[model samples]
Each structure stands twice: as structure tokens, then as C-alpha cells.
Target: MHRDIVYASPTAGGEQRDLRLDLQIPRTKGPKPLVVYITGGGFMTANKAGNLDERTYVAEQGYAVASIEYRTTTTGSTYKDGVADVKSAIRYLRAHSAELGIDTAKVAVWGQSAGGYLAAMAGATSGTDRFEQGDNLDQSSDVQAVVDQFGVHDLAKVADDFDPETKATYMAPGSFINAYVFGPNSARTVVTDHAANRAANPATYLNRSSAPVALLHGDNDHIISPSQSLILLDALTRKRVEGTRYVVKGADHGDLPFLPDPEAGRKWTTQKVMGTITRFLDRELRS
Candidate 1:
């Protein structure tokens, strides 16, 4: 376990902040594939150690898991800033692959909710220079695969898919989208900011060369509708990109069934869910 490893120091609002990652490497013989995990906090806050147990379980399966920190609304940052931070972390891992025992050729990004959105952005915009800011310019930020769980793919249409109550809250002032994308006080909501919403949409950057994506969403998710994944899947199919979708029955935004039972001292994910993710990652990164 490597804790608080500084990956980049990007200047924001005339002040520099250190971005770090907590890494767990398997006790394998050679360098292992890397799975970068991004935590979810409604794009407002982030903690690298949020899902340590799940990451450790992935590491135990002969892979290196890196839980990364990205700038969020609490840091006065936006979606673009978050994507830049994620790409910078990827470049940093590749640059320091030898010392970190990471297999530079095989890397994937996995995230839940807001993190999932960032992962989709990173995968869709691979080889593009739009958000490749920070150090390690020589190393590419292209990921082999992406695992997005209950991510908001299209901000423009996301609110429409939500229930009436959820939509009302999402469109209200100082909502998550308002604070994270536009300024906290900005009158622009996801409904009014069509251009900004399009800019932040992962589907806007999808191409034939984009990384293969595996999307998982809960059917009972009210915060982020299951239609979000369907929209992304439709985009992936349009581009002829390899894509897979999974709908977890009877799961909520970030609640039981998907997460492990804490009372049982289990890891972050359940055995069945983790197995599904592992197989997809193995097919993309190990095969």
C-alpha cells in the first residue's frame, strides 16, 4: 500500500494544490495492470481512500489499484479541471511505471457516479489534447478500458430522465450540476446551459478510436437514471466502439446490493459484482 503519493501539483485560482493517489499493488512476480479508481461525491468532494476495500480486492486479483483524488466543487474546480487531474494522474503513473510496478501498456479507469463521468471522459477523449494539462506530457493518457457505474453521461438530458421530484431538485439553484460545472451562484442550470452541458458530455467526444467501455447502472437509481447508461451505450454503438452494459436490479444510487456488507467485514464490492468487473477488465487489459 502506497499512501499519499503526490502525482501532480496543478495551480488553481492562483494557488497550487497537490493531487495524490493511494495505490495498492498485488504481490505478483512482474508488473501488473493498473486500474485507477475515482471516488464519487456528487462532483463536490472526493476522497482517495473512499473505497479501499474494493481496491484491495482488485489488487489481490493480480492488478494494481490506484484510488485518485481530483479537484471538485469544494476546491472551486469544474468538470474540465477534474478531467485534467484524472489524465495527469494517468500520465504520472505511466511515467513512474518502473518504480511503481505498473504495466504501462495495460491500464484502465474505473469510477462510480461523478468519478464514472470522469472515467468516461478520459476514455472517450483518448489521444486528444483538450484536457492533457499538467506534467508528464510525453506519456499518453489513453486508457485501454473504462468502467463507469451510474455515471451521468449527458448532462443536457440527464434531468429529463429523472423523476419529477428528482428533476426539480436537480434543476434548482445551487444544485450539483450548477455548483460543479457553472459557479455556485450562476443562474445557469443544466437546462439552460446546453452548450456547457454538451461540452462536458462524454458522448460528445466518442470516436471509433475511443477505448472500450463497460457501463453499470442500477435499475432503481433515482439520482442518476438508468437511461444515462443507455444513452452512453447508444453513443458507443453509434461509433462502433466496443461497449458493454449491465443493469443491477433493485439497486439505488450508492446503496446496498452493489456495495459489500460492512457487518460481514467484506470488501467494497460483492463477490458477484466484482467478478463481473474483473472479467471485463481482464478481457480488455489482460487479453
Candidate 2:
């Protein structure tokens, strides 16, 4: 049976914002890896109940899936708040690892788009306790591996090269991310605020301690450019960090609906993405 778990106030200001998780457990007594799945909405609209259909499919694959809801730009303009919420979710799950039947040692964090960024962050910062406050050491929120699909890894770099002539038009109202992160200056400051931009970026924290990551992105994505993934892969390689990156031939950003179509290039690329993720996870978790 599926369970919906609530984690109350993992952090200081999270008292009013309890995290909701959709836990899907397979009907087996044997131990299985716990996959923490994060949904993508450009850091704006998705929640813990991400695409229920997909959750069911993933559960049928013989793994328990925990779909997480994190604080979005809608809750705050800064990126730290969202990052804080994800870290809190991990801690909450780890704290209840026994009750939830979570194989904490084999945890895999996976997500798409903004959620992908969070997954990568969770894996990379597994050993760091930046989100912990006071003296709570009972929880172990480390991630063994990461699966990032069209996730945004670099914000400062993206902003620096954002189309100068049409930056305003691109981030206008109704554009989910624009509406969520910047209400008034959604168009202007996304390109203007240097300090704010840096603080909201994920690439700023990369180091040798980061966990292994598998990246899947579309080469033709206009929103979060493929260049972002390329840069991230390059950095990971430079640091001698284990990582895998694949660029879909023609798929757009977050367009899973267009996958594996015989007429489209995504058909071939989708197969590669699946193999890469499976192999990466097997090596990271079962090794």
C-alpha cells in the first residue's frame, strides 16, 4: 500500500511549511533501494504528488519511491529556501528510515529540471551538514547517487548570457519561473542582480566531495540551455568526479511526452538515457 507521510518543521522557519511525501513501497519483504524523486516545474509549480501515473510505474519497477515537495521560488525569491526544504526532506526521511523501510545506505535522489538541480545538490553535498541546526546528529541524509534530467546546474552563467535584447520578454509574467522567482523584477533583475544570482546558482558549490551524478538533457532546449549541463559535466570531470552526461537530439526542455517516438530522434536517445541511468545507479548503489 502507498503511504503519504508528513514531516513537520525540519528547519527553523519551516514550522508553517510541513513537507509532504508520497511514499510508494513495493509488495515484497526483501530490502530495496529507496528512490527519492523530485518533480520539475521550473522551481515553481510541481509538488510531492508529481505525475501519479509515473509514480505507479516506478513502483512497479521494484523500488520504493518517495516523491518530495520542496519550497519553491513562490515561497521565497532566494534559492537557499528551496535547497533548505530539500535538505530537510532528506533528513526527515533518514530520521524515519526504519519505519519507512528506507535503505538509507542505498538512497538514490532523482529528479527533472529544477528538481534535478536539487537531486544533484543532495548527492554532491551528502557529507556536508550545512542545513543542520543545533545538535541533531541522529539523522543521516546522505545520497548515494543522483539522476538529473534537464536540471539547471548553473544559474550565474545562464544569467550572464541570457538573451540581452529579449531577456524581459522571455521572463515575462505567466512564465512560471519568472512569476515564481521575480514578481516585479522577473524580467529586469534576473539579469541585473549579481549577488542574488550567485546565491541562487548551484554550480557555485561544486567540489571533490560531491557524489556521482548522471545528467540527461535535450540539446535543443531553449529554456534551460544544454550548455548548462555541458559546463557542469566539464567541471565535474576537472574535479575528477564521476559523472555521465547525454544530450537528447531534438527534445525540448522537460518534454518527456515526446520520448521514444520512432519518427523522432528522441526514440534512440531515450534508450541511451535509460541505460545510462540504470548502469550509473547499479554501480553507485550496488557496488
Candidate 3:
């Protein structure tokens, strides 16, 4: 594990932050395919190190994997800020690909939850200006594929579901995500601002040039609706973006462990889920 490699310095609130990422590179030589795993924090608090196990799993599959850092809403950052940091990380890896022994042309972004949204956006809005932040503008931030693990693609739609706690009886914000993705209370006003919502939405930027996408959402994922991935799928279908969605039957967010069932004692492992993602990446990257 190569630790604390600085990727960018972005100003958060009134202060500048030196963002970093850690990489796990396989022993096999020569321009390996790269996969950047963005950690899920609900756009509040989490670190790159949180996804170390997954990063190592990916590296063992013969891909260079990195656990990247991105600013959260608590730091006065928006979805754009997080995505920008994501793009910068990609560009940074590409810019120094030779030193890292990675194939810049075969990059992929994979993330869970909020990180998954960033991954989808990074792949969908490649040439467009969804976000063009940080350093290394010369190198393309385009990824060959996207593996979105239960991500929320449409913030506006989500906001409408639970802005005033109309959907549930309990404290919704703690369980159900309020649209704090772009800004505080932005989701509540999202219906009024079509342009802002469209700009912030990943589905709005899909085109034929968009990379192939793989969406993995658990059917029981209540935090971010399972339909969220389906909505993105609908846009991708219309735009003719090659994509696939694996709706897991029984699972929840951050349920990282593979829980074995009673009889077989081998039921709940995320191995099948991980395999689905890797298979898609291999086909997309042509690795």
C-alpha cells in the first residue's frame, strides 16, 4: 500500500485542504488497469482508508486500486467538489501513469453510496463540464467504465420523497437521506430550479459517448432507493449507453460482510457482488 500520495489541494470553506489517496498495486508488471474506489460517507464524514479491504481485493485481481479522499458537505463542499476531486485523482494517476505502471486509457471509477454517485457522474459526464476542478486539466478524466454500488443518481427526486418527512413516521433524515448532496436544503428547492437539478443530475448528461455502466443495488437498500439505479438505467437506455444493473435481493447499505446463511453457512458473502463488478470492468476495459 503506497500511502498518503497528495492528489490535489482544494479550498474547503475558507481553508485549503491537501487531498490524498493510497494505492495498492499488484506485483505483475506493465501498465495495469486502474480502479479508483471512492468511500461512502453520505457526503459528511469518511476517509479513503475505510475502503482498504475492497481496494486490496481489487488489487489482487490484477488491477491497481486506490482509496481516494473527497470533501464532504460538512466541509462546505458540494457534489461538484467531490466529483472534481475524483476527476483530479484520475488525472493525477494518468499524469503519472508511467511512474505508477498503470494504463491511463483503461481507468475505471468504482464507489459505494455517495462515492457511487460520483463514480457514475465521472463516467457519464466525461467531455462535458459537470465538473472540471483541481489540477491536471491536460489529461482526460474520462473513465472506461463505471461500477456504481447502490448510488443515488437523482438528488431532486430523492429530496421530494423526504423533505418534510412525508414518507415515513420515524426520523427520516437519519435513515432516509435528505438531499444534502449539493447543498443544504437544495433538495427541498430542487423542484423549482430545473436547470440546477438538471446540471446536478447524472442522467441529464448521458450521451452515446458515455462509458458502459454497471449499477449494483440491493433491492432492500432503503437509504438510497433501488429505483434510483433504475432511473439512471432508463436514461442510459434512451441515450444508448451500454449498461447493466444487478438488483441484489437481500442486502442493505454498508453491509460489507458476506453473512453466511444457516444451512449452507455461505449465503451472505459479497463475493458474488464483487464478481459482478469485476466481470463488467473486464469486459468494459477489455483487460
Candidate 4:
């Protein structure tokens, strides 16, 4: 269902890693739309195989889907490096579109939790320079749409509110975002680096030409406050860009359905989420 490839040369660590992605192709002959799905681990630890069941479901819907890999901050990779790796992944995939049986031009980047931030970055910075890294520079790394599930929109805001006194920190030293901004090991001062976080936030990059984005967030997401989505919604509205969010009521971080019982008809189901996503993708990518 997938293959591995070294998309880049040796990193600053002098180790050339074999970054891999799972590519699932439908039986259709012609090139199909691509969904590059990213997994979330708060930027600390996670991989391409994190969300297998969901991605396979998308692939079954007549598309060439990919679950991509990116270096995490826990491995000494910076926030910029992670985004660059994602951009490079997109570029590498597009470069080999013919081989992968994918429609290079109709790609969507999708992710959950922290990966949601990466997916948003992929869509927001499409034509922008600076984030692109590694090989396959000729192919465009832009994605048509972004499907983010509970990713933070403003890092600085979160860091600012994350225990201003340092005693009540929302993010511990082991958190990947802290590693991203302050290296793998962090000082108390690193949590309050407002300026740095502001500079790298996705909200700072939004514009009229930014690709359409759809966010699915639990209203009661304890890990990432729903306020993050509100901030993004406000920014997107102000920018006059096409963006929307689905707030799953009474839902927490790991719960897909808002209700306590799956049999309850009052909450969202896996099929409901997929239907929303597939319909949005079709409206944005299909004719």
C-alpha cells in the first residue's frame, strides 16, 4: 500500500534519513486527486503510519492518498524544518506524480492535532518562498485545500497564556512545540518567547489567495483550546478567505463522536466526518 524514499540529502546531523510515505491508489486508471495526510504528536513524536484507517478510507473514495512523514522537534528539528519537510514531501510527491498515479495539481493536505498546523501551513504558504526545502525544487509544493483537525492557530498566544508565571505551564518540557521553539531541552524563559512564536504562526501568513481551509475541532478539546479555532476563524473572516470550522459539541481530544455512546444519534460519526471531508474536497478540487 506504500513505499519509502529518501526525499532529501543528509540533514544537519549528517545523517540522510529515509523519509517515507504510504501511497494508496484507487483502481481507476487516470490520475486521481491526492490527499497528503499528516499525523499529529504535538511535534514531538509521530509518523506516517499514525492514522492508517482514516487515510485508507479516503483512498477508497477514488483518490490517490498519501500519509507523509516529517522530522519532529524531539529529533532536534526546528518548526521551520518540519514545515519545510512537509513542503518537500509535497514537492517530491508532485515530482513523481506520473509514477504514483496522482493528480499533481489537485492535492489536499490533511492532518490531525499538531499535524493540523502543518497542513494549514501547507495551504497558507502555497506560493510563498522561504519554507521550501530539500530536493524537487522544480515542482510546486502548493496544496489546493487544507483539512485541519484541532491544530493550534497562534503559537504565541498559546505560549503567552500557558502559565505566564511559569509555574502553571500548559506545555511541559517534553512537549514537541517547546522543542521546536527552544530546542529539545528548554528553559522556563522559552515558554514566553512571544515574538518568536508570533513570527512562525500560520495566522501571520493568511491572505486572499490562500487556499480554502476547513477545520474540524472539538469544542471541548482540552489539549488545544477551541479558542484557537475561533482566532483562526476571525482571521479568515477578516481576510475574506474561504475558511470554515465544524465544532463537535461536547467532544474531547480523542473522542470522535460528541456523545458518550456511539449508538447515540445526536453526535458525529466517522461516516459523518468523512462525508463532510469528501464533499468539501469534491467542491474544492473536482469540477
Candidate 5:
């Protein structure tokens, strides 16, 4: 496990913040395929070590798992900066692949909630010059595949699939989504600005050259509707990009049925839910 490795020091809000990542490498002899994991915190906070257990499991499957930290709302950064930070981290990893024992040819990004949104953007916007900023400019930030878990794809139409109560709450003026899209406490709704909404939507960037994507969403996810994944899949299909969707039944946003809970005898670990992700990564990265 390599901890607190500074991937980039990009300027955000007139201050340069050093972004770091914790990498868990497998015990295998050869350079391993990399899986970059981004955590979910409503786009406000990010912890690189937040999903260590799950990431370690992926490392055990012979892949290097890197849990990355990106600039968030609390850091005075918006989705655009967050996307750039993700790409910068990828470029940094690719630049240091030889020393890090990473297989530069094979790379994937996986994330939940807000991070998942960024992951989808990373995959959909591959080769896009705008998001590919910061250090390691010569290296490509293009990933081979993407695993988006309950992420918001279309920011403008996110409320279209939400329940009445959820829509009323999330689309409120001072909601987190507002803060995420606009500034921290700006009096602006996410869908109000058409151009900004389209810029933030991952589906808007989909093309034939975009990486294949595997979207996993819980049917019972009230925070992010399952229809969000469908929207992305639809765009992928239209663009002739390979896309797959898995709607987990009876699973909430980040609850027991979707994630593992040993105390509740929930075995939705590597053999089940995680297995689905590993299999996709195997096919996309190892094949």
C-alpha cells in the first residue's frame, strides 16, 4: 500500500492544493492493471482512504486500486475542476506507471455517487482537451473502461426521474446540487443554466471514441434515480459506444443490500456485487 502520494498540485480558487491518492498494489509479480476508485461525499468532501476495504478486495483480484482525492465544493472547486483533477490524477499515474508497477495500457475508473459522476465524465470525455489539464500533459488520461455506481449523468434532466418529494428537496434553491453546480452558496439551481448543465452532463460528451462503460445503480436509490444510468446508456448506444447497465434490486443509495454488511449477514462482497465489477474490469482491462 502506497499512501499519500501527491498526484498533482493544481490551483483552485487562487490557491494550489496538493491532491493525493492511496494505491493498493497486488502481490503479483507483473505490472498490474489499475482501477482508480473515487469516493462519494455529495461533491462536498472526498477521502482517498474511504473505501479501503473494497479497494483492497480489488487489489486481491490482481489489480492495482488507487483511491484518489479530487477537489470538491468545500475546496472551492466545482465539477469542472473536479473533472480536471481526476484527469490529472490519471495522467500522473500513467506518467509514473513504470515506478508504480502499473500497466499503462489497461486502466479503469470506478466511483460511487458524486465520484461516479466524475468517473463517467472521465470515460465519456476521453481525449477531450479541456479536461486534460495540470501536470503530465504528455500522458493521456484516457481510461479503457468506466464503472459508474449510481451517478448523475445528465445534470439538466436529473430531476425528471426523481420522485416528487426527492425532487422538491434536491432541486430546492440551497440544495447541495446547487452548490455543486454553481458556487458554494450561490442562489442558482442546477438546471437553470442550460449551457452549464450541458457542460456538466457526462452524456453530452459521449462519442464513439469514449471508453466502454458499466453502470450499476440501485433501483431503490432515492438520492440518485436509477434512470440516470439509463440516460447514459441511451447516449452511449446512440454514439455506438459499448455500454452495460446493472440495476440492483432493493438496494438504496449506499445501504446494506448494495454494499456489504457482515453484521447483517449480507455477503454482497467479492462473490456477488463486487464480482460483477471485477468481471467487467477483467473483460475490459485484462482481455
Candidate 6:
């Protein structure tokens, strides 16, 4: 089913900033699992329509996909707001589970770069209880698994060790992370604030209860660095959580060549990683 896109309700402030959501389902008669896909644009550039092709590919594999639009990292929207939007989108999906024709419990999340980080946050953290401004704390919007591609794990960790060259490349207004997580309020020192950054970084929340994770990073990534994945992998190990990490050789951040060979990249991304995610969801959600 190639369904049209829909928008959820606005935030608490009455901004018309609705979350864009789309559904893609295969032609199969029986129901299938759902995958909520978030895009990577440092929280500013991409939208639900922007990544329809990839969503279609996943849907063709007999899974339903929900693509969401979060507040941009540059449009004065705080990082917390973006996270809230994703959580709300999942709530919307669960609320409409019958109409969407998919198992609400079987949903997983997948994203690249900044979006990946958000996906991880969605997986690790529970839905809003108080910290989030517009969160519906009562909603059960948690995800079952996560696929993080070159996403940041520890914002404070990366901020402290950002190479000078990387800093120059990300010459926004404040520090790269400041601009990323805080937007123009980069000077707010949220990166160093244990309460703030701790809530934002997925690494800080990993524990025995965390969903299984699949982390893919390019060994040559200059953006978030391959070490980002290593950090999360280490955390997962420390917590005794099931997880997998794949370091693609020679690939830069978001570049295809840096992945294993093209064929392997396709297989690893769509088949191997997807399979692992599907199996994990089966175990966690279906079991």
C-alpha cells in the first residue's frame, strides 16, 4: 500500500509544525512489522517525502514503514523538541494501529547520522514523563530495535575530542554540537551539562533493558567519527545488551564507497542488518 502522507497535531505552542508521516506496506495480505525511518540532515534539511524511495524499498520487503519529519536542527527548534516530535509520531502510529494495518508492538527505528542519534534516543529512552515540553507522557511509543548509521553516541565525548579540522568543516555559529543539539543557543553549555547532554546522547541511557542495536559506521568518517559507534558498542557490552557494530572500510561519513563493497553494502544494509533487526523485533515484540 502506497499511502499518502499525513501530519500529526502541532506542538504545545500551537505551531503548525505537524510531524509528517507516511506509510508503505507490501502487497502481502497478512500483516507485517513496522519500521519508523528518520532522515539525516543534522535535524534541519530532510523530510518524510525526501526519503520515500528508500522507504519503498523497505516496504517491498514486506514491512510497513513510518517516515517522520522532525524539527530542523537549524530552525530555532531545540533538540528536545525534535526528540519530542519523533516520540509523538510513534504515538500517532500506535494510536492508529488498526487503520495502519501493522503490529504496533513490532515497530523499529532506523536513521542516519543525526537522525540515527535520535532513533537511538527513541529506543533507549522512555516516552516523555516531564523533561519533554510537548510529550504525552502516558503514550506507549517506545521502539523495539534501532539501526544507527554513523550517528553520534556521546555528544559530550565527541565535543571534547572534536578534531580541529572537523571543527572547521562544521563551522556553524557555535561549536558543532552546540549548533547541532542546541541550534543558535549553542552557547548554553548544554553539551557539558550532565542533565542536558545526558538526556540527549543515547550512550548515556544504555542498560539491560535497552533494545538491541545495529551500529554501522564508516572507518574514515570525519563527521561523527567511527569511535562514536565504538563507544556505544562498549556501552552495550558493559550493560550486557545484545548489539552489533560494523565498521565499513575507506568510507567517509554518509559516503557509499566507505562501506564494504557496493554489493556487500546493499546486502549488509538491507538484508543482514535488516534481518538482525527483524529477528530482534520478533524476539522482543512477538515473543
- Give each model's clash number: 0, 0, 3, 0, 0, 2
Error of 5 at 117 (Å): 0.3
Give the top-scoring candidate (TM-score): 1
lDDT (10s digit) by residue, model 1, range 1-287: 99999999987656899999999988778999999999887887788878676777788889999999999887678899999999999999999999998897978999988899999999999968879898999999999899998888887666676678888788776788777778657788767878888888999898866899999887877667789999999999998988999987776676222344443223226787789899999999999
Candidate 3 Cα misplacement greater than 4 A, ranges: 159-188, 255-269
lDDT of 2 by residue, 1-287 (tens): 45557754444233465567888888788766777888877765556765565556556666678888776655543345566666666677777778877676778888887888778777766677755432225776677788888777655444333576444554444354444445433453544666655545555556666778888887766667678788778878877778888877776765343232334334324445556666776788877
lDDT of 3 by residue, 114-166 (tens): 88888989999887765887789988888889999878787656533343664
Worst 10 residues of 5 by lDDT: 261-270
Per-model TM-score on C-alpha atoms: 0.93, 0.81, 0.87, 0.88, 0.93, 0.81
Which residue pairs collide in model 1, if any? none
Report the C-alpha lDDT of model 6 over 1-287, residue by residue, as the tens digit.
Answer: 44445545555334565556777777778767888888777555655664455567667767888777787654666667766777777777777777768877667888878788888887777533423444444557777788888888777666334677664444444664666566665555543466776767776676555778888887766567678888888888887777888877665666232233344334335565456555655565567
lDDT for model 2: 0.66
lDDT of 2 at 111: 83
Q: Which stretches of candidate 4 lie over 4 Å from their true place?
A: 9-14, 159-167, 171-175, 188-191, 255-269
Clashing pairs in 6: 43-73, 251-258
Better of 4 and 6 by lDDT: 4
The model with the greatest lDDT is 1
Ranking by TM-score: 1, 5, 4, 3, 6, 2
Candidate 6, RMSD to the unseen true structure:
4.1
> Which of 3 and 4 is ahead in lDDT?
3
Which stretch of 10 consecutive residues in model 6 shows the poorest summed lDDT? Answer: 255-264
Clashes of 4: 0
List the candidates ranked by lDDT, beginning with the highest: 1, 5, 3, 4, 6, 2
Q: Judged by lDDT relative to the true structure, which candidate is superior, 2 or 6?
A: 6
Models, CA RMSD each: 2.7, 4.3, 4.1, 3.8, 2.6, 4.1
